[model samples]
Each structure stands twice: as C-alpha cells, then as structure tokens.
Target chain A: QQPVQSPQAVILREGEDAVINCSSSKALYSVHWYRQKHGEAPVFLMILLKGGEQKGHEKISASFNEKKQQSSLYLTASQLSYSGTYFCGTLGGSNYKLTFGKGTLLTVNP
Target chain B: DAGITQSPRHKVTETGTPVTLRCHQTENHRYMYWYRQDPGHGLRLIHYSYGVKDTDKGEVSDGYSVSRSKTEDFLLTLESATSSQTSVYFCAITGDRGNTEAFFGQGTRLTVV
Candidate 1:
C-alpha cells in the first residue's frame, strides 16, 4: 500500500523550516526520500533504516520511527533549490519494492 | 547521475493500442523498477525486476506487463493502452533492495488519446 503524507503543500521563506510527514499502515523496514524538480527526475535524498536512525543530507534530515511506521523529513534554512515535490517511499516486510506517498509540494521563496 | 536512460521521452498513442517503454542502465544494478507519476498520485510502482527473467507485479500492475531479457534492459509494456494510462513513466535502478538509494531515468511522458 502507498504511504500517506501530511500537509499536501507548504510554502516557506528562504530561511524558514518545514516538515513533511509520511505514515504507513504496514510495518516498514526502511524509508527512502526523494526530491523532484519541475520536469526532472526524482533525486535521491536519504534513506532511513529499520533501526529508527536519523539520516541527513546537507541541511535536510529525516527521522524514522519503527514502532509507528512513520518518517519525517526536515528542511532547515530552506533554500530556493529546495523547492520541489518531496516523496517518501516505504519498504515493508521482505519485499524490495518501494511504495511512495502522494507527495508534499514544498515551495521556498526568496 | 547513475547512467540510466528512458526512450521516447514523449509519446502519444490511441486507446486500445500497445505501447512499450524501454529502460537501459549502465550501472549494472541488481534491481530495476517502473513507476508512473500522476498529478496527485505521486509516483506509484507498476512493476520491478530483481534480475534477468525475474519480474514481479507492483501496486499498480494491472493492465501492465514487464520483461527483463538482459541485465542491462527492462521493458514495461501496456498490452492495451487506455486514457487512464496517460502519465509520466519513470524507470529506476538500485544496487540493493531498500538498502540503497534509487536512481531514476529522465522519464517518459505518455499520452493516450
């Protein structure tokens, strides 16, 4: 099943912060995050393992909660380059197939 | 970039026609995936292959079939296209399942009329 993402859309100033949450009904073994710009491919961000560890990419970071099957992406001091659609993908059970959330549109203005 | 390429970046086909999208990778990854991107649906998995001749259905596998005859290529086919299948298709590759980052192709925009 596809994961659910909160705050379908968010607008932020260049120096603001934002959070995008993803919740899955099934137990997740790992969570993957990607950012896609307009008319471009989705770029890999960071992957959180099953240990509930936190991972970071530059100023962006994410935390995974194994017990709740949820993950959140945090963007601090958002930059104009951070403006794009963010998708959270979940891998459950032993299946390698990744299921992604509908996505959260993040717009960072100057 | 992970050396992934998707053919026919833009395509328009009539309803009930068959269409095939090709994904070629030079990274020699062990896993390949097909996904469709819709306005509000985000990116939904259609099918994936673990290795040559080893394929499996995904969340939205209906009306779609996949074949991997070689390690470098994975093909997604729509046996009979429909208007509902019109969406941007992407092909991704990963070195490991859920253990590594996935690299996506440029994407193919398919329009069914």
Candidate 2:
C-alpha cells in the first residue's frame, strides 16, 4: 500500500525547521527516507524498523511509530542543499517490496 | 554510487512501437526493480526480479514486461507503447531485503510521441 505524505509542498527559510509526515493504512515492518534533487535520482537518507524509534542523519532525523502506521521526518536548521522532494518508502504486506509515497517538496530559501 | 547503469538516458519513440529499457549492475545484487516517476504518482513499480529467470509484476505492470536472464541485467519491455507511458524510469538494486539501502540509477527519460 502507498503511504500518504502531508504538506505536498512547503517553503522554508534557511536555518528554519520543518517536519514531513508519512502515514500508511497497513501495518509496516520498516520505513525508509529518501531525498531527490531536481532531475536526479533519489538518495537514501535513513531507515526505521522499530516502533518509537528515532534516527538522525546530519541535520535531518526521523521517527517511526509502528502502532500508528506513521513516520515523521524532521529537518532542523535547514540549508539550501535540503531543497528537494522527500519520499517515504514502506515495506509491508507479505513481501519486502517498498511502496513509496507521493513525496513532500521542501524548498529552503536564503 | 551502487554501480547501477541505465541505457538510453533519453528516448523518444512513436506510439504502437515496441520499446525496451536496459538496466545493468556491477554490485551483483540479488534484487532489482523498475520504477517510473510521474508528477503526481511519485514512483510506481513496474516490475522486479529477485533472481535470474524469476520476475513478478508490480502495481503498474500493464503493457509492460520484464525479463532477467542474468544476474546483472534486467530488461523492461513495452509491447505497444502509448503516450501514457511517457515518464522517467529508474532502476534500483539492493542486496539485503530488510533495512538495507537501495541504490538508484540516473533514470531514463522516455517520451512516446
């Protein structure tokens, strides 16, 4: 099943903070985060497998709530490089195949 | 980079013509996938192969077929291309099944005119 991301698009200033939420209708075994720039392939950011778990990468971090079938990605003190579409991939159902969400477009301006 | 390469980074084909996209990998990963990215659909899976000679359909498999005859190569074929098939296709590879990083290729921008 595909996850739903909130705030299809957001604008932020440099050094600002933002949060992207990913929700699913099915039980998830793992959740993944990826960032893609304009005309570029998506790059992996982080993965969360356990409930109530929080993981960070540089100024970006994410939390997974298995019970609620939701995950939130937090970008703190955003930078110009953080402007891109953020996607959340979930592995559920009977197989490990990941279904990604529509994605959240984050634009950080100077 | 994960040593994944997609051929024909850009292609423009006529409708009703058959088209095939190639994906090659040097990482020798066991799992490979084909996905198309659109404006509102994000990334929709076309097909995937877990091993040589083994393939399965994805959510958007209509008009598309896949074959994996070798460990490093996966091919996606469109029997009769249509304008709806115009999208950027990406090939991905991953070694592990759970909590592992998946690497993506540069992507092939295909236009069916």
Candidate 3:
C-alpha cells in the first residue's frame, strides 16, 4: 500500500520552517525522501534505514520512527530553491518496490 | 549523474499502439526500477529488476510490462497504450538495498491519444 502524507500543501516565507509527515500501515525497512520540481523527475534527498534513525542535509532533516511506521521531513530556514513537491518513499518486507506518498507541495516565498 | 539515460525523452502515440521506453545505465547497477508520475500521485513503481532476467511487478503494474535482459539496461513497455498511461516515466538505478540512494533519469514524458 502507498504511504500517507500530511499537510497536502504548505506555503512558507523565507527563513521559516515547516514539516511534512508520512505514515505507513505496514512495517517499513527504510524511508526515502525526495524532492521534485515542476515537470521534472523526483530527486533523491536522503534515506533512513531501519532502526528509527535520523538524517540531515543542510537545513533539511528527516526522522524515521520504525515503531510508529512513520517518517517526518523537517525544513528549517527554508529557501526559495526548496519550493517544490516533497514525497516520501517506503520499502517494506520483501517488497523491492518503493511506495510513495501522495506528496506535499511546499512553496517558499522570498 | 550516475550515468543513467532514458531514451525518447518525449513521445506521443495513439492509443492501442505499443510503446517502449528504454533505460540505460553505465554505472552497472544491479538494481533498476521504472516509475510513473501523475498529478496527485507522487511516483508509483511500475516494475523493478534485481538482476538480469529477474523482475517483479509493482502496485501499478497492470498495463505495463518490463524487462531487464542485461545489467546495464532495463526497458518498460506498454502493451497497449491508453490515455490514462500518459504520464512522465522515470528510470532509476541503485547500487544496493536500504541505506542507499537511487539515481533517477531525466524522465520520459509519454502522451497517448
């Protein structure tokens, strides 16, 4: 099944912070985060393996809670370049397929 | 940037016609995947291959078929294109499971009339 993402869309001002959440009903072995611009393919941002770990990239950070089967992407001091759609991909069990969330559209204005 | 390339970046074909999208990877990754992106749906996996001749269906694999005859190439074919199949297709390659990031191609935008 596909994961669920909260806050379908968010608009933020420069230097503001926002959070996008993803939850899956099935047990997940890993959670992957990606950002896609208009009319472009999704680009990999980070991957959080099992064990409920957290990973960071500059002002963007993500946390995976294995127990809850949920993950959250945090954007701090947002930049205009961060204006795009964010998606969370989850892998579970023997499934090699990465089920993605409906996606969260983030618009950061300068 | 992982030497992944997708052919026919943009294509337009009539319904009921067969369309094939090819993905070539120079990185020699063992795992390759095909996904489609739509308006509301982020990216849905169509098919994936772990090795040559080893493939598996994804959630949205009904109308789409895929093949991986070589380590460096994977192909997605639409047996009979439909208007609903008109979307952007992406090809991705990963070196290993979990913990690793997959690199995506520019994508192929296919339109069916």
Best by DockQ: 1
lDDT of 2 by residue, A19-109 (tens): 9999999888888899999999999998888655444366678888889999999999999999999999887846757778989999999
Model 2, C-alpha of B54: deviation from truth (Å): 2.3
lDDT of 1 by residue, A65-91 (tens): 899999999999899999999999998
Which of candidates 1 and 2 is the stronger one according to DockQ? 1
Across residues B3-100, which tens digit of lDDT does each residue of candidate 2 receive?
99999899999999999999999999998999999998888888988899988888899999999999999999999999999999999998876457
Return the candidate ranking by TM-score, descending.
Answer: 1, 3, 2
Say which candidate scores most in lDDT: 1
Candidate 1 off by > 4 Å: A52-56
Candidate 2, residue B71: CA error in Å?
1.5
Using all chains and alpha carbons, the TM-scores for the candidates as numbered come to: 0.97, 0.95, 0.96
Give residue A79's error in model 1 in angstroms.
Answer: 1.0
Candidate 2, residue B78: the lDDT equals 93
lDDT of each: 0.93, 0.90, 0.89
CAPRI category for model 3:
medium
